[model samples]
Target: MFHAIPYILSLIAAICAALPVLLLEPSRTQSAGEIRLVHLLVTWNPAITAILLALGLVLAARSFFRLENRAARAALLIPVAVLGLGTYAARVNVFEKMFAPLPDPGFVAAHQADFLSPHDLVLGVSLGDESKAYPVGIVAYHHIVNDRLSDEPFVVTY
Candidate 1:
């Protein structure tokens, strides 16, 4: 029951998303590969994650009512507690996501190099649309150029 309910809920969500993907495309103002707002809203990973999490939570709560043994409740509570904490974390993060858009997938895929600690290395490079937060005022005592960030495969000159 725990597993089956989540799958059913996800199926319903997919159907909901599909309606917008098909029906809403004609109404969009932009042309080309522009991402539609409906696309962004309905297909956002967080939205789907929230749906799945809610369904799982409901299932968990349902199980709690059916449980008999005290030990069974204790075992179930561990996962339930973790899910609760996870849901809380996801909720807090979801609002933050809408403001700052996800980086372009092409930019991310184009340059998929692993990030290294830049402060230690006087010379380091980061390519693609991947972002690495480097400590300010801690960069190597050398030349640094922040303007080269938009040149295709961006190279942070430092």
Candidate 2:
């Protein structure tokens, strides 16, 4: 039982860390009750994950000294490795890193009919005498556009 405790705790921590990110989309569209539950999970999972990882590390360190077989020791190391990696991933915000926001994107001028399909969506902004259009297709991928209009800096995001 003691030998398995670290693995169990590490697994639980990893799953908890991953759950909020995985459920983000569904949570947004869920009923109020479900959304509240997911909101609580997303808000608290990080701290919970950290605590679980710390406890798992302690247990793994304690168990390491008691293990006799080489293979058993090697197997015991797996959960510790996973806990370390998971902690790093959680700290780094791996999902956001994977789809990092665009930085200072540029724009091109072209006839609307040349590039845009008639049915496509776009975001339009007007500031004083300046007007700009951002195709939804482009902004959907990068999630942000930085630009200046009327000498004022602003960002557009979807």
Q: Candidate 2, after superposition: displacement of residue 80 in Å?
A: 1.0
Best-matching candidate per TM-score = 2
Q: Write the per-residue lDDT of candidate 2 for residues 1-158, one digit (tens) a residue.
A: 99899999888877766765666663356568766775786677667767878898888878888998878877877888878766765665544676667776766665734678877898988899878888899888877677888999998888
lDDT of 1 at 71: 74
Across residues 1-158, which tens digit of lDDT does each residue of candidate 1 receive?
55345445544454444443454445556543345654564446356646666866787677667778677655665555544444444334332343343233222332453453433333334557644433332233222334344365442323
Off by over 4 Å in 1: 1-43, 88-158
lDDT for position 27 in model 1: 57
Candidate 2's error at 21, in angstroms?
3.5
How close to the true structure is residue 18 of candidate 1, measured as C-alpha lDDT?
A: 49
Cα error, candidate 1, residue 157 (Å): 9.5
On lDDT, the leading prediction is: 2
RMSD each, Å: 14.0, 3.9
